[model samples]
Target: MAPKDPLLGTLKVCVLNLQSDGEMVTDTNPHLASCCELLELVLRKGLQQPVISLVHRDYWQCFEQLTHQDPCGRLSALSLAVEQTRVCRKLLSAQGRGRYLLRLALSRKALPQFITHLLHTPRVLEWYSPTTSILRNEEFVEPFMSLLLVLSHMEFKLNMENCSFLDESWLLPVCETYEVVPCREVGMALRYLSGRVFVLNLKPGSQAYVDKFICPW
Candidate 1:
């Protein structure tokens, strides 16, 4: 069982400080210890787990406190939260699964935050949710879907949802641009693609839109 009050007070202090001070937490600080500790607790058990909310409350506290900081440190904590949310879905699925809407809601809520954080550090996109299929390994369907949402919200003109399911026939098209052979990863790729469901051409020479995800490839 999880600790009943695992690191709760510590997190609160951090959050409060963040809200009030904001700038002080950016560089190495005494509070970073607390921050790291809280992250450890959340990572081990998960964010939806009671301990996680406690950590989250504190994380927000710290975020409010550290407005002057570079925001880099906070990215790890946020990423962990996103991962934890994803884990909940895995657990739900393992228990013989139910409707995807519940999973979608939880999954859907976490992406925007993660996307915003990564936007500050463009390279972070490669590590957290990469667009290049050739460089990306493993099935990171939710984060990638979330990425599509961010791009859509940004009005990038690509339909991530539509392009997500690039048909085997479409695979030929995807390959011509990306230099990647998607055939090997069909099933996993399709899972990520399912959200968009189909594709459309925006207009002549405007770029192809699939599931509303606009991609150069």
Candidate 2:
């Protein structure tokens, strides 16, 4: 159900558009870029008119800051994601950087992991004021994440190589698009989850782990 609040309602529409647009989203086409913009607008909508002035922020900018704040590498995944985006010789602008990382996460099927990771990192999460940002707001964040779980079923075949032009604009020449058919292994896993029996293979010497997954049943 869409939130009754007008702001959350608008965001829900954008999220639904992402699902309704098609089974796949790629920046090589402008339509996906348009959808990204709508999402971006909603994310920034709350931050745009703050009682205080702040730097023009993109989601990636938060990751960049998080990388600096976490020198110990406690959050190595965030650090690596930030580093990859930073070293991507193509993107020059923050907007392009954000889109690049977003698409990368989508294509890798790791967007949910990234979102959950961000929620746990308060030092970085504070950039978004709880009053305006959906990611920070309790009323809005859970629904947004639920919609993402719905998206988890769809395959995203974004071309990371096509990002060189993103610095200029989201629109770009078409490269290619494909709806990846799930491999047989995935199908087998689905069958197992559906109640098919399967044998387990566990190898271990010890570490308080031998009796855990290795015990007879």
Candidate 3:
């Protein structure tokens, strides 16, 4: 048979290193190592090829399995990986495939649980800031922010009761910031979320005016 591809081999090693318990091997570089392998796979085989597609699918499957086994640990691993600019830029800039993969990984059935976890977990939401100054300085907040964006695009209904963590007082300020400067993906996400908030008639207290402020166009 043909000699094994180094990048593929590396990817296999990384996947195997992810223990069934939802933790990754501390010694392994999940982001750099996985990103390098992904980049190589995309460059050499292209995303449509059977081999590359299988690898991509398998990588996500591993994450999903781990997530099901241990939500907190899986989110921790994902947060760590996405904090790397190289990994974030690659995943966020790949013709939107990164976003697609993320959406797929957090299927509708799992989204409510994930969002609930995000809100309840202090460490996970620590980076979420209502202040523009704080948000601007925070570099590791993208993964958390990206999840909200993906959730905005989901088709299924969200349980309003589970959304108690979404304090309107704080969310309003964050939404206002997005409206003024428009942070691309974030702006879109805010817009979508705002629309949903209005449609759902979720009480936003003083932030109810957000419905009028948001441009429907």
TM-score of 1: 0.21
In order of appearance, the predictions have TM-scores of: 0.21, 0.63, 0.22
Choose the strongest candidate by lDDT.
2
lDDT of 3 by residue, 92-125 (tens): 2333333333333233334334444444544433
Cα error, residue 83 of model 3, in Å, equals 26
Model 2, span 28-147: residue lDDT tens: 444566555655554565543335656566666765666676557676766677778889987888888887877766666666667777777787677677876788777777876775
Candidate 2 Cα misplacement greater than 4 A, ranges: 1-24, 27-31, 48-55, 69-74, 175-217
Off by over 4 Å in 1: 1-4, 46-112, 115-217
lDDT of 1 at 150: 33
Instruction: Give the Å shift of residue 95 in candidate 2.
Output: 1.4
Q: Is candidate 1 or candidate 3 better by TM-score?
A: 3
lDDT of 2: 0.63
Estimate the overall C-alpha local distance difference test score of candidate 3: 0.34
lDDT values for all models: 0.32, 0.63, 0.34
Lowest-scoring 10 consecutive residues by lDDT in candidate 3? 164-173
Candidate number with the higher lDDT (1 or 3): 3
Candidate 1 worst ten-residue window by lDDT: 94-103
